[model samples]
Target: MGKKYNRVLLKLSGEALLGEQGHGIDADILSTYAQEIKAVQEAGVEVSVVIGGGNIFRGVKGATQGMDRVQGDYMGMLATMINSMALQDALEQIEVQTRLMSAIRMEAIAEPYIRRRAVRHLEKGRVVIFGAGTGNPYFTTDTAGSLRAIEIEADVILKGTRVDGIFDSDPEKNKEAKKFDQITGDEVLKRRLSVMDLTAFTLCRENETPIIVFNMNKKGNLKRIVVDGEPVGTTVIWD
Candidate 1:
């Protein structure tokens, strides 16, 4: 099958790096992700990755427990940088050339984020990993992913979650929750579906960027969605 998306932004949760563990990165899962990403890269897809830091820290969660919002957010951003570094290492170990860019300007660990430079990296066939969650408090990695995807002019945002797709309700909490094969962006906003934060969702809606929420833990699913055009996820797009 022909490729459905030539270039894409992949949004991954920090918790996903844990694999079967409860905290931190799991070697096996990292290896699996590296392998899958390598396969997609070999298929001629340009990839930009944005990973969350929920497993290590979460600003909102910290605030609920009484931490200052800005300070908590900065810490959370650091967590994302840690995860990004781990992912970059894994990808490089598998022979996938990668560049880790940070919004927080850590020259020691990562290069400062520059839009044109990032796009150039992609053009050069290197996987670019974005870290530090927009370098701003009150914005999530989801928003960062959306913003970076738009900046890079990617075809779509592949939200790689543990769940197979978007559901009418929380599938883990309610077995009766039904999954949608496809849904309109307006409908998602109208129904208050939690596909992403309001800011991120609105950015995508206003920009006409489509999103695919799928189970990234599943082997071959990335190829199915990017190359084979299989309906493995709930697609959210302008109708």
Candidate 2:
């Protein structure tokens, strides 16, 4: 019950959106997600989300054995849009006003990346979900999260991942992996931790934005992290 921050940027892995089956968006899953986000919004936390594309495309899946990395990345960005739309729909179904902003300039389904417009939506108490991964090839959703968080001036980056927090190894795979209760971005970089891509960690560190890497499985995890500040998982800071 010692949380002191407000207005954060949440980054949800595409896999997190998949509830039980762990594939695509699930109804019970999405409904639960809507409720989690709703709880945070009700707490007066300006929330912005940057979703990943891994649930659909791994990029190299569509790439020919010798496909260009750039084109493959473009495909990955588009895949994120699909997930974004699904989230937007789910949020709206629960009567949570939300907006989809794409970095790839897809005016047909969403607004292009506009910093001012995104911040305005957050100020108006609407959740803005950023899609399409920086509108450029060779960039991961992790990078997009960093970029959007900086633009929106978020207090911290809440990274919802498969595990509770950063582990020395894959806790799911390794029987005796070590977990860190608190760590620094420099340590994450020095140790080459896989918690986030190097680009994201460096960008956030440069902007002095702390990252909270936590589990997304619990029903009220999001709200708990926002209000309780009792970190449901590990906190990555820049010392």
Candidate 3:
């Protein structure tokens, strides 16, 4: 009947946008995500999103092929902007208000990332999509998501992945991998579970921010977790 989180930061991988495609974003997946986001927003949930750029380019992968790491990371940031713009366009097409903010100054395409402005946008019920991955090299989008969530004082970080939840091992590879309904941050580190990178995980742990990992591809799953207050995924807490 009531929403679970008042405000949330949704962390999504750029590769998730590749849905059934080889190298680019799928229109169907974009449409589905837009609709899902719209549902939660309409239900009065303040949402902020940070999407990765792995679909287009990965700095580490490029570095192995002889590309300079810093240059490649900047390129990756641009790739995220591309995805962010697409999502903004899709949401606008469906009449959902959204603001695209980038860490890197891009006056033509998006507003510069301003903390107060971002929170104000959220307060006014506009979905804020944060792009460009912290504007720093060697940091993943996961870190950006965690940083923004803390800065915005979001109730939780909803990590929307392809999997249903976090597992002891890679669920796709290990048929017998165990799932935890809820887990502690220390336990996650002790078991070496790959939820987020160490830097991002540390930030969340220090801030006592909770993270919910769930299957983003599943229709109604987002609503179930955010609006219906259903236990639809694995919840990672600091305690």
Candidate 4:
């Protein structure tokens, strides 16, 4: 096997947490993720996580419904914190050391996010979950994941999605879509693929952080990528 990435930031969308349910957290899905993360940690990979809040609330959707944009965004952030807390509790149940940090000041629920402290927690083999997005309106959780990955100097971002990898088009909608084994950041931009938002994609590109888009629903995929160095997903890298 080839060398494995030492530290990685795993990005899980809020929708991922909703396994079979159309909305809300599904216990089975949460348990599966916690087990996967624990297996990866046992293999000596430092892990941190950032989860989105679209399952619970979407700021743009709220704005379309005539709600205040900023207020809706804040509510979205709070939703992420809720998801983070759920994830934290699940990981702990599996005996994985975990930390829940929030960008927003919610001292009672989570520790305020501090760059060095987060790194230290990772150093101590604790899985740090970053919640509340960027603590500011208008920035997506994808941006928060990118910012935290850069801050902690992660080797890659393991983007856990429903699909196996990034395709030329949405695989769900287009059965004929083509999948790329490996791709360049520039190509993704030129093709206008929706891997990440432009802001997060640019940040990863400029920083030379590789991103692996894989299906987390597949059991053992996480451990295979982090421990065995298996190319189980499409790797997006700087050319």
Candidate 5:
């Protein structure tokens, strides 16, 4: 089967890396994600990743505790860098060439984010991981993912979550919540489903970049969606 997308931006929550553990990254989860990513890449999909820092630290949580908002956000950015480095290591271990680019410019560990360089890396079939959350405070990694995806002209944004797809209500809490195989972005906004922050969703809506929310923990699902062109997730469209 032909691939569904030429390039995609994968947005993952840091908490997804926790697995059964309460804190930090689980080695098993990291390995599984790396393998899933490798499968898609090998199938000729240009992939870029943006992972959240919620598992390690959340700036909003810190701010609620009276910490300076900017300082807390910067710390959160560093936490994302930590997760990015781990994923980079895991991908490299599996012989997948990758480049870790940081928005905040930590020269010792990551190269500073440059749009041209990042696109070049993707063109060469290297998976690029974007870290540090837009190099600014007050923006979630979701916003960063949308920004990067549009910048690189990715065909879609693949949000890898624990859930099967977007639902009308919290599927974990509300057993009767309805699931939509496909929905318009306007409906997502009107219903206020938290697929992503408003800023991020608005970016995608304006740019016409489709978003697929799917279960990344399910082995082979990534390949099925990207390579086999299966409808394994809920697709958010602009129309």
Candidate 6:
């Protein structure tokens, strides 16, 4: 990519923080993430993050079991707090300056979400993790990523996911599924692609924020995606 973009939002699912076997947070995984982030920061690229709580609480899973939708969403938001804390700690362990900002303030642990302050942190080279999922019910972390991307004026939103790229069919189920290297946001939604929720993609399209969906589980993928940009995954944008 040759550093086509300077600042980006790295949206990581809570599952991405968990290593193979996928139950609890893995120290090794956390360490690897810290190093990847640190390497990027050192390279002079400002990065912010939004972490999903799917590893701990997938909201729909609760709703499917009869939990009230709002309650389930709140549970999912809390799950994100746990991931945010882990990320903050992991980054700090590597001596990387970081800020954990929450939409719903939990004063003892993190600072309340402040757009200006968060921007300042990134400008000063601190990695910021936006947590608590828009602090409202019925909004996915995908929306949170879009919102933060706009607020921070990120060059792009890099959604770190489990898959290598967007496919016509579930690659896990269909070995013949074809992966797309790049596609427009409209095309993604037109085909009902798995890149992101429709609402999230809409916001990005409306605001002209490009998104990169790439496999986050592989070693060195983070750095590679930022640098090589060698058609690593599906890219959704107006351009």
Query: Candidate 5: TM-score?
Result: 0.97
Instruction: Report the lDDT of model 5 for residue 156.
Output: 93
lDDT of 4 by residue, 1-239 (tens): 33398899999999998887878899999999999999889888899999999888842464547878898889899999989999999999989999999999989999999999999999999999999999999999999999999999999999999999999999999999999989999899999999999988988988998999999999999998888989998999798
Q: If scored against the real structure, what TM-score would every candidate get?
A: 0.95, 0.93, 0.97, 0.96, 0.97, 0.92
Per-residue lDDT of model 5, residues 1-239, tens digit only: 47988999999999999998878899999999999999999989999999999888842474458878888889889889999999999999999999999999889999999999999999999999999999999999999999999999999999999989999999999999988899999999899999999999999999999999999999999999888889988999998
Clash count list over all predictions: 0, 1, 0, 0, 0, 0
- On TM-score, the stronger of 4 and 5 is 5
19-65 per-residue lDDT for model 3 (tens digits)? 87767788899999999999999999999999998887742464547
Residue-by-residue lDDT tens digits, candidate 6, 68-161: 8898888889899998899889899888999999999799998999999999999999999999999999999999999999988999889887
Q: Which candidate order results from sorting by lDDT in descending order?
A: 5, 3, 4, 1, 6, 2
* Greater-TM-score candidate between 2 and 4: 4
Which residue pairs overlap in candidate 3's backbone? Answer: none
In model 3, which runs have C-alpha deviations exceeding 4 angstroms?
Answer: 58-64
Q: Order of all candidates by TM-score, from best down to worst?
A: 5, 3, 4, 1, 2, 6
User: If candidate 4 were superposed on the true structure by all CA atoms, what would the RMSD be?
Assistant: 1.8
For model 6, what is the C-alpha lDDT against the true structure?
0.85
Q: Which stretches of model 1 miss by more than 4 angstroms? A: 58-64
Give residue 113's error in model 4 in angstroms.
0.4
Which residue pairs clash within candidate 5? Answer: none
- Root-mean-square deviation of candidate 3: 1.6
Worst 10 contiguous positions by lDDT, candidate 1: 58-67
By summed lDDT, the worst window of 10 consecutive residues in model 5 runs over 58-67
